[model samples]
Target: MTGSPLLALPGAVVGEGLDAGVAAHYGNPMVEQRRLEQGRAFVDLSHRGVLTVTGPDRLTWLNSMASQALDRLAPGEGAEALFLDASGHVEHAVHFVDDGGRTWLVVERDEAAPLAAWLDRMRFMLRVEVADVTAEVAVVGVMADPSALPAPHAADAIVWHDPWSAASPRGYQYARDPQHPASAWNWTELVVPRAWLSELADAVRSGRAEVAGVLALEALRIAAWRPRFATEVDDKTLPHELDWLRSAVDLHKGCYRGQETVAKVMNLGRPPRRLVMLHLDGSDTVLPVAGDPVVGEKVRPEPAPGEATERRVVGRITSAAMHHELGPIALAVVKRAVPATIELIVESHGIDVAAAQVEIVPADAGAAVEVPRLPRLGVRP
Candidate 1:
């Protein structure tokens, strides 16, 4: 991994491994979060990756390949797309923006190379040109600034403005919030040159620019109930379960790789699982992290003397955070059969915390197919 540019800023703490992976914070997440919510700071997203596609057939070709209808994507327009296997399992979550001359894709850091390679293989006779541009560009997150950085690539820093602030175009929202946290979500990622990082951080220190860290961004993102490809997706993940129809998957788009499964599940079957926001009980002072087992109160066999019944694992936490206002919160994936009123427990290192489920997708979603009535003895011959 290359050194991140935000390290030039004072008090920068780079979180290595799965949890932090990038600049966790410049000391205090609360202060940084305040700065971000107030549009006074930016987050360093250089650890992520970027890919660009250019060609006359880019839009139409992409339209036929992904989950969204991209053929009509106008310049400066942005939309989310998902790459799925033929079985409909989510393979990749894509953030895309078209700037007329080029279509930029923002993906998880480790996925850029593989995604570009896949695109190349699918370009047999199309005019599409695919390139992994991670080495040439960096991603910077901001609450409001859209100014391009002073670098060749940054000259037209393609900004993929987040559409989570409101209900997406023709998308379905399962959760209703009168004052949604995303309502103030002005998150935007700026694609800049790798060399411009230090200058941007310096601008933050000299009071010329404002900056935050990934921790603050994560906290706010989790609070908004947004799903991220890095932490939220697994090999068995399905878009409908996450309520991703709010942005990623369009129900009326032309056929794509996994359209069969997507359409089938949307019209005839219910996803095996559903997404929920967990309002965790913080009395234990223990917060669960991603992959923590979400155990429910299911029937268990009798225990021996001085023993406790074994509770079956019903779900797993995908993301968790301590929000400035919402306190400790998390997002979890649970079985579709799990009842809405059930309370879950997160067992972490022998500590247990109570979790209340807030529905993102109703467990019974898409299970409305009618069954035929059997003929009775008194029926007409």
Candidate 2:
């Protein structure tokens, strides 16, 4: 399939569309990063997929299927939803925005075909139309002042403004720090016609605009402790584990796929595992990959068989990046019971790297950690 024309630029390091898609860096990642942080750069995320759902039943119908309440969504509003299997395992993470007439869905490129097929199969008798419009439209991510971008393609271009508003009304944050990176997170994506890439590319070529690669974006995302479907999810993954409940799942929303498991896990107990940010030591010069084992100093009273070593692999790195502000950082999935005080190690390929645990999902990650008291039968405050 053809992709964003900008990917052909010199020094553009292209990789799989999911992880590093367009460019790793346009020669200097640092300069590109500044431009992005200052709202002067954008990323060509057209490599991702775009699917649209039309017809009158779009909102109500979608509400019945995803983990978010979409029925009340007004025009130009956006929300993140998860499609899960019967057992509540997240199958797809959808970032969508609606313009009254059509609801646009953004997801990993590889996920488009399958997800579209499933949606089609589910639309038995509903007045819904699902179409993959990826080829006709492109997605460009920008961190610069979004207002500066041209208006959306009259009924064609749709800008999905991220509501990284520290916290949303329908969400709850497990990380209570006021200075969390997400509190300042800034990014937005613009959907344009496929042919618009050349003009945008020319702007970067003529020094009118700056182009930052996915690597820079990934670094910012990691620093912000944001989770992505491509890097952080697995078959057994639950939203709570990644503190995603703060942004994705609506606690009191109506039913949808995986609602039961989500409610049960959040209310009655903690997720079996949790997501944590790792401040990796760069001394070893080895960066952990998605599957790199994260071992912790064994504090088990009795080491399990084959676990006699002082440290045992307890988790794996989900995403890693070298940030502009923070040196080397990574997000890892680890057992919920793991102590936050433990020394985590990522030893792989003859590199022994030490990591400091910065809890994204606190060890006590549960929804009902505090119970509210019922007011006296007839008494008032």
Candidate 3:
């Protein structure tokens, strides 16, 4: 993991493990989170990966392989796409934007190499060229508005504004909440030269702009019901389970790798699992981390003896955070059979913490289209 120049600032605490080499916070996390919420701060995501694809065949080639319709994506417009395996499981969640000549793909830190290799293999006879430029550029994240950054830096930066709030014409939304939290999630990522990181650090130090840590950014993302590939996805995860079809999967687009399963789930079957926001019990002062088991009681039928009910694992927490206002919250993916009305217990550090379910993906999250039944031969109209 390459270190960011901002880590040299006073009170900057570097993150550990997977978030190594990045500042987790700068002395005061609460204040930083508030600044971020108000669009007054920027997050140093230089640790994330950046890839660039350039060629005349770039748009058409990517559109044929990606779940999103990218063939007609105009320059400066940003979109999300999913690269799924043959079995319809999500392999990658890509955020990309084109600047006419070049297309930039901003992905999770660990995905850069693998994605580049895969794209290179798929190039075949196409003119597209894939290069992992993670070391050449840094990814800076801004919320609400991106124009708050300093003048010269913002002028030459390539920005990828998130399109999660809007409905895709070729996609379908499974989460039917009238007031979805994502409507306020105006997130954007800017690609800037790595050497310019010091300028951003100076801005933070001089009060020209504020800076927030990854923790603050993640808390707000979970609150917004945003699905990040790194945290929310696993081997068996499907896009419908996270309501990702709303932004990443194009239902009406031409066939891709997992189009059969995507179509079947959307038109005839429901996803096996569903995503839910967990409002955790903060009394224990313990927030369950990612991969924590979510358990619930279930009735066992035809028990051998006196066993009438037992506790069973129903789901697992994908991401958890301590929000500045919302207290402790998490996003979990649970079995579709898990009743939304039931209170779940999160097993965190051998302690059971109560979690109330806030429905994100409904139990019946697929089979969206209504199919008409044919009349029998002898039946009247």
State TM-scores per candidate. Answer: 0.91, 0.91, 0.94
Q: lDDT: which candidate is best?
A: 3
**RMSD values, in order shown:** 3.2, 4.7, 2.4
Residue pairs of candidate 2 with colliding backbone atoms: 39-144, 153-157
Q: Write the per-residue lDDT of candidate 1 for residues 1-381, one digit (tens) a residue.
A: 567767857888887655345688889998888888777777888878799999999999888889988888999889889999998989988889999999999998888889998999999899989998888888887777564233343356778888777777666665554665667777888877776777886676777776777878888888877889888889999888887878788877757999898878876788889888999999887878889999987644765687765587889999888888888889999999988888899987689999998887776676435656689998897
What stretches of model 3 exceed 4 Å from their correct place? 299-309, 372-381
**Candidate 1 positional error at 233, Å:** 0.6
Per-residue lDDT of candidate 2, residues 1-381 (tens digit): 565678778788775536455667777776777778778778878788899999999999988988877888899888888888888888998988998899999998889999999999999899999999988888888874454344343245687766654676776677766788886677788778888888778776877666888888888888889898888999999888888777777877857888898888877778889889999998777788888999987557877887656767789999998877788899999998888888899876768899999988888666665668799898988
Model 3: lowest-lDDT 10 consecutive positions = 299-308
On lDDT, the stronger of 2 and 3 is 3
The digit string of per-residue lDDT tens for model 3 on 263-378 reads: 88888999999999999999989989899999997766667787766899999999998999999999999999888798899999989999999998887565777888899899
Give candidate 3's whole-model lDDT: 0.89
Using TM-score as the measure, what is the rank order of every candidate, best first? 3, 2, 1
How many clashes in each structure? 1, 2, 0
